[model samples]
Target: MSTLNIRKITPTFGAEITGIDLNQPLTPEQEADIVSAIAEYGVCVYPNTGLTDQTHIWFSRMFGNLWTIGGQGTRLSRFDYPHLFEAGNLTPEGGISTDEMARKRRAGDRLWHTDSSFTKERTTYSLLLAHEVPAEGGETGFADMRGAYGALPQAMKDRIEHLEAEHSYLYSRSLAGFPVTEEEVENGMIARHKLVHTHPGSGRKSLYIASHALRITGMAKEEGRALIKELLDFGTQPQFTFNHYWKPGDLVIWDNFCTMHRGGEYDDIHHRRDMRRTTVMAYPPPPVVMDPRFKDRFDPAQFEAMVDA
Candidate 1:
């Protein structure tokens, strides 16, 4: 714990953490320090590391329960560790779909998003391990939410402070021409969250924006569209982002609570690109009550049943 080394990559983004092998069990102090570092840095990279499946699960549990992907099954692909959720091309032997579906799946992740933001109780963190990286162009990029919020114009900041937006998994998948099933859309998997979220642990405010956000509350359709476009442009500026080129055995962990990330496109038709991601869920957001006048049209009992399902 005392022997660990932490190096900041940028004033607002990433950190290179050295010392402390992942294969070894962490002490209580070491775990505390690691959590603190993640809060401070947003993203941390442990390079040239090897972790067993059990160790990966144990390390991830230190933060919280591991987040299960919404539509994907409970287990990983046969080629991957059960604890890890695989992303990218289909395996040679067997997989969920053919090579074409895998290609479309990889393509859909190109836009920026916090992992599992569509869920009511979204994932708090994401741990990604590079098992196989394409030789050409499959880097993952992260945007610093704190930096994005800080750089906003005062007028824009004031406008969005009280605003809320609807996040939908269907919208995210639709961007790649792969929409979620009717059951998923009807099951209340979509959620609404504030445009500005205060970190529960640190009390720091961050821009809670992502490519999956479909609309903002109390704003006209055209107005919401324009505002979202403007904010996304400002938030994803290169200065506020860190792009990671992966090598095998590299493990990268980031706080999904205050960061947005996207996958860079690669030759999915040919080159093999595979990464395993695990998400940790957090507490649910406070409820938002609709107007009483609309109660008849928007039934509370129906909504509750949808969420409970």
Candidate 2:
């Protein structure tokens, strides 16, 4: 492995890395450098890597265990690869899907979020590869949560230091106007995570709130919503964000522990945009303690059993 041609895309958080061949296996030193880059800069982009589904999954596994689309099964999956998430507007046959569920899931991606936050074993990294892109728009915006935490007022920092929040994908999808069914709610897709976290890899404090974070644990629902909104707004300020305009063959990786991301708008109906992603799970959070307030909606025993395996 030779020296990586690293260039900072912004003063705060993103970097564009070159001189690495995604088609081949990476050396230990090369892997270390990439991990270091992620710790310091929340997002890294490799332009024109030309990674296919296999190579993309291979490169992602070099980091940690992958979060597969298992619970929902292959019914929602577009590609033959179960570990690779179909994040684009197209179907397996290379046509835009008219499925209502697929459309709503894409709509939920527009909100700022950290991948797998609503799961019991949250994800640490997300590697998104753009196989095809629209002629215009469809950029992904990333916000540095580490920087956001540092910029908070002392009082705000003191307040959220030991707080915890409840995250639910079922709830988040409903925010995008996806009608929730009784059966889906019975699946118990809720999780609990610290409101403020000390990232073990980077040793930096970061805000862990996202669109999936529906409410603060033990707090009034309205109050929790206000606080979560305020923190999200502050974290996603212009200075803390970097938007990546996609081009075919571009691979972008982001550390979910230190950042939040959202998909930018494009004419998905008119033009095809095929993006695939592999999520790496790491730093397993604490067990989800059932909240009595939401007992009617979630079963704690079911959540633990589903996640433990």
Candidate 3:
């Protein structure tokens, strides 16, 4: 492990880390340092030059168990890897989504939200790597929810401090007019999370509102949604965000627990935009220890031949 050189990109919570390569397996100490970096700063960018798909999976696994997204318009990043989700317009056979409704559903991603917020499992972090980028647009922006919470009025904070929000992918998909079946909704695609979350590592407070947060629990839908909108607008103000322009092999890792993010619109039809992401779970179940690869992991390791850091 080598010492890392970090440059803060934003005053509140984003940093660029240099002096490590993702292509190689990480030492335990290096993994700890990288994890610590994300804890202190809401986002960390590591240039993954010459990185392979396997290497990306290997590095991401060091953080924790990766979250697999299923159901409704999910295009797998790679057929062999279910943990990696494609964040682009291209299809499994390599073509863009031509359907306007399908494109709109993808476009709904433009709304600021945390990844996998609708899931029952806690999403700790997200590692996104740019494979192919466009000439312009397609920038990913992140909001400093910790900073957003810090700047809130005491009265407002008191009002929302203990409230919980019911998050649902069904609700968000509806916002984009993406059709879904009632059976899918009944399959348990909804969850409730604290409106405000405390980072386990630093014990700092953060506003956890997002587009997936459909309504506050036990409150009128309209009033709860209005409050959610208000908080999202406040958190995304320019002063609290850092908009990242992607470069090839640029790996941006963000702490999903303390921030909100969105994909920027680009020339998807004329220009191709390809990206891949692996989401790490915050509270994973105990590993099936019988599987050597999952020594202390939650889910069974996908590639057991690879060694853990």
Q: Highest lDDT: give the candidate number.
A: 2
> Candidate 1 lDDT, tens digit per residue, 1-309?
355698888876899888888777788888888888899889999887787555665677677655433235433355433345766575734333344655555566898888877866677888988777888898989999888898888998899999998888777776677746645654645688999989765678898888778778788967996887788888899999989899988889998878889998776666777677766657432254533432232233433343355
C-alpha lDDT values of all predictions: 0.74, 0.84, 0.81
Candidate 2 is scored at a TM of 0.88
Name the runs in model 3 displaced over 4 angstroms.
Answer: 69-78, 179-188, 287-301, 305-309
CA shift at 119, candidate 3, in angstroms? 0.9
Residue pairs with colliding backbones in model 2 are none
What's the TM-score of each model vs. the native?
0.83, 0.88, 0.89
For every candidate in turn, the CA RMSD to the true structure comes to 8.0, 6.7, 3.8
lDDT (10s digit) by residue, model 3, range 1-309: 436789999875899999987787777888888888898999998875656667887888888787655543554444466667888878777777676876877866888998878976668889998889889999999999999999999999999999999888777776766776656655656889999878786799999878888789999989999999999999999999988999999999998889899999898997778888888877745632333432333446554644442
C-alpha lDDT of candidate 1 relative to the true structure: 0.74
In model 3, which range of ten residues has the least summed lDDT? Answer: 288-297
Instruction: Estimate, for each residue in 55-89, the C-alpha lDDT of model 2 and write its tens digit.
Output: 88778877776665655555566676557788899
